[model samples]
Target: MNASPIFHRLALLAPLLCLGFVSISCTGYQLQTGRPQALTHVKKISVPLFENKTLVPRGEILATNSVVDAITNDGTYHIATLHEADAVLEGTMETITYSQVRSTRLDTLRSEEMENTVTLHWQLLDASTRKILSTGKATGSSRFAIDANQQTARQNALPDALQRAATQVVGRLTDDF
Candidate 1:
């Protein structure tokens, strides 16, 4: 019946609605905020055979393969051969130093714990422009109880640690760019 109550309610809500709209509109234009822009220009990515400077064999290959898998699975970029892509990803393993030592019961012949650590350095670059997009190092470590032999424990833990580092490095390179 009376328009007074309706008008009062509308007046109270109008400013709040307007503010909400303005905030949404501002966020819509925020740079690099939404789904990644389609990698139109660099449709194809070339991952050269990574060089394994570590004492471990195929360390670089494993890291490179993981990166390629991430890019391919991302569905945004196509994997191209070394000479056929718009951008090339090259990486060199600067270091891979790890120690496997007893962590528990130092005085006792039978130790209760063991630890393993894997450290790696990596870089990502755009081949066409020769631009270094990102470069950093990542490390992964794991510990487990050992009954008798340390070598077996070290070997088993090393791969998993390396895998962790590889995934972290690749995810950083792919998602941030």
Candidate 2:
């Protein structure tokens, strides 16, 4: 009878012991909510329309929109109008290039896969002083199959490239990477 009661007490306590161990194991984990030291003072930023130096039409709109969208999604900085912003992000779409990534086995001259790359030059400036705080170049690329409609395929991949470049720019600005 004594053994039976002891076993029952241990059985009831096992779950609590297990839970305690789990909680203790997680004590080292911590939530990260702080920004990088370099950008701690910047809270709101404004992105202007990117200048398109490339030959592609409307490339500026796409690049600018992509950066704005990325900044909005990062949640590190608030998007504000030029008048209300603490900083201004200016970008120029410098180049859009396409290269053959993979050639068809049957034809060396034919491209089976192609990569689209977008290069953007950006500057972060103080809103009040118009002084450049940071400047960098970000490049983004996307690979796509060269289907029968090569133009359509290239067009579809352009946005992805722009988005990647935008993300890199934002990461550099906020994460200091």
Candidate 3:
């Protein structure tokens, strides 16, 4: 019932709790493992036209749009069209592999499910420092079903697959950089 006990307990723990908070806040200053190296003057970013090394003709456009979207959406840096920006993101679509993974039957094995996998290799470079800030790969896969018509199903699945791949690639680039 005495106020003295409560005051004594608060005084005892106040310093320890303050120290813990201070340590937590200070930890943010340390560089994370894959974080981009610190820049001295660069504040803008330019993502060059991505090269689509894959046979798929649209791969380059999709990857480029994804990177630009991700970077602009984050609002962390200025997105630039000129190559003189602080950082540049470059990407290559290595492969786009498709396969029929499963066959389903509503009445008889007439419906089939197919999957498409897309793999991309990307790097973030610090333009000023000429250093590779981060390098990594990302992959995404999507599946769709075809009933009696293989071509139609494949056509329908392509957009979905490309979108998924682009999203994943963007996520990996941002998270790593």
Give the winner by lDDT: 2
Question: Between prediction 2 and prediction 3, which has the larger lDDT?
Answer: 2
Using TM-score as the measure, name the better of candidate 1 and candidate 3: 3
lDDT of 2: 0.91
What TM-score would candidate 2 get against the native?
0.80
Q: Write the per-residue lDDT of candidate 2 for residues 35-151, one digit (tens) a residue.
A: 556566778999989999988888999999999999889988889999999889999999999999999898989999999999999999989998887889999999999989998
In model 2, the runs with Cα more than 4 Å from the true position are 1-34
Model 3 bad stretches (over 4 Å): 1-43, 105-111, 147-152
What are the Cα lDDT values of the candidates? 0.66, 0.91, 0.69
Candidate with top TM-score is 2
Candidates' TM-scores? 0.61, 0.80, 0.63
TM-score computed on alpha carbons, candidate 3: 0.63
Predicted candidate 3 versus true structure: per-residue lDDT over 1-177, tens digit per residue:
667987899999999999999999897596544323443344677888888887766668777776677666665556886666877778887887887677554544444677888777877788766698667787778788767777677656665666666566555554532
Q: Go through the candidates in order and give the C-alpha RMSD of each one to the true structure.
A: 4.9, 3.4, 4.9
| Decreasing lDDT order of the candidates | 2, 3, 1
Distance from true position, residue 33, model 3, in Å? 15
Candidate 1, pairs of clashing residues: none
| Candidate 3 residue pairs in backbone clash | none
Clashes of 2: 0
